[model samples]
Target: MKIGLYFGTFNPVHIGHLILANHMAEHSDLDQIWMVVTPHNPHKNKSTLLDDFHRLHMVHLATEDFAKIKPSDIEFKLAQPNYTVNTLVHLEEKYAHHTFSLLMGEDNLKSLHKWKNYDVILQNHDIYVYPRLEAKGPNREAISSEQENVALKNHPKIHLIDAPVVEISSTFIRNNIKEGKNIRPLVPAKVWEYLDHNLFYKK
Candidate 1:
């Protein structure tokens, strides 16, 4: 089976995430897209991150309606500072039958060479990149400044995809939560209900 690995902290899985996953699943040869919730990203600051288990649960809630999307707790079972290279290796060993591809935004794809053992990942697995605003769209200004991932030394394994645009961002949702603003529209209705009932992200 062709599985697309969609990695994120998923602080709270929202509509935008679902939209991207759905688009990938529909367009690609992926049998399923596993939303692997990383416990800790080596390059990202962990101070603002929610508990991994909590974030994973939120992903579960948000993905319950979609059959092709699944929330995975793979990183929780691994060592700290979960790196994509290590995770991919472990997944290949554990699930021998499944073929995997990495699904990510064009921004990340452009920065691929900077990641650990990027060469191995580039050669071993397919990388599916969805276009970013800077590449084609007029929405140059984002909710937060993501480094313009303009420099791309393309590898043979890379595959670019044009997933439907959904501007809703996870950072914007978190900022709204911090500012005591409503997150109803930012997340799916079920995820909104889960956040409300569980008192998640209260200031």
Candidate 2:
């Protein structure tokens, strides 16, 4: 089996995340796309992040109906500030029969050099990079090509996928929730229900 690991903090899973994962599962060479809920991301600010278990549950709620995409809490048992290389190694050991690949946004590819053992990750597994709308400008194609050149440098393991880009973000959802606005269009129905029931992100 071929698995694509989509790792994220998932402060609250939103439609953008679902779309990306589903596209990877259906369009890519991956048999399954596992949304790995990272407990703590070394590069991200942790103060605003929801608890690991809560984030994991939100991921479950968001992806429950999807057959090819599933939620994983593998990083919960691992050390804090989970490193991608370590997680990949552990997963490889546990699921020896499965070939694993990494799923990420083109934005992340721009800064891939900062990640610990990034070279090792590239050497061991393939990386499927999906497009992300740039914040400063609308030139996605140019930015994507430039970032890909910097990160991949024609690496055979890196694959650039032309998937539909969803503009919604978890931060946008949270801000709306805090302002008592509707997030129905920004998240899965089940996930919206879960957040509403739990009063998550409420001020």
Candidate 3:
């Protein structure tokens, strides 16, 4: 089986996540999409993050109806400050029968060189890159940032997929939910119910 690992904190899975994962599952040659829930993203602030299991359960609710996209807590048991290279090695050893690839946005591709043992990651797995629109905000200018990584972008193993540019983000959803706004349309019905019942991100 060819599994595409879509790693994220998922902080709370939303429509944007589902859309992209579904697109990859249907459009790409990948046999399955593993929405790996990272316990700790080195780049993110841990204080704002919800409990690992809370975030994981929300992913479960969000993807329960999608057969091809499943939630994975593979990183929770690993050492903190999770790194992509290590997870790939672990999965390779455990699921040697399954071939694994990475599912990432073009922006992440630009910064790929900075990841730990990024060379090893590229050598062993193919990367499926999707289009992502940078949100224009204060002191931020929106441009075609995807075109910045010329060298990596042209790699033989890197595939630039024509997936839709989903602009929605977990930060956007969390801010609205805290303000008592209806985010029903932004998340799966079951996921919305789960978040609401638990009063998540409402503080």
Poorly placed runs, candidate 1 (over 4 Å): 41-45, 137-154
lDDT of 3 by residue, 1-203 (tens): 99999999887888999999999999999999999998865567776688889989989988888899999998887887768899999999999999999998866677788889988888889999887765223212222343344357568889988888777889999999999999999888988888999899999
lDDT of candidate 1? Answer: 0.80
How many clashes does each candidate structure show, in the order listed? 0, 0, 0
Q: Please give the CA lDDT of all the candidate structures.
A: 0.80, 0.85, 0.85
After the best TM-score superposition of candidate 1, give how far the Cα of residue 130 lies from its true spot, in angstroms: 0.5
lDDT of 1 by residue, 85-135 (tens): 999999999999998899988666656767999878877899888876665
Q: Sorted by lDDT, highest first, which candidate order results?
A: 3, 2, 1
Task: Give the alpha carbon lDDT tens digit for every residue of 4-78 in model 2.
Answer: 999887878888898889989999889999999878655677766888788888888888899999999887778
Give the backbone clash total of model 1.
0
Select the stronger candidate by TM-score from 1 and 2: 2
Which residue ranges in model 2 land beyond 4 Å of their true spot? Answer: 41-46, 135-151
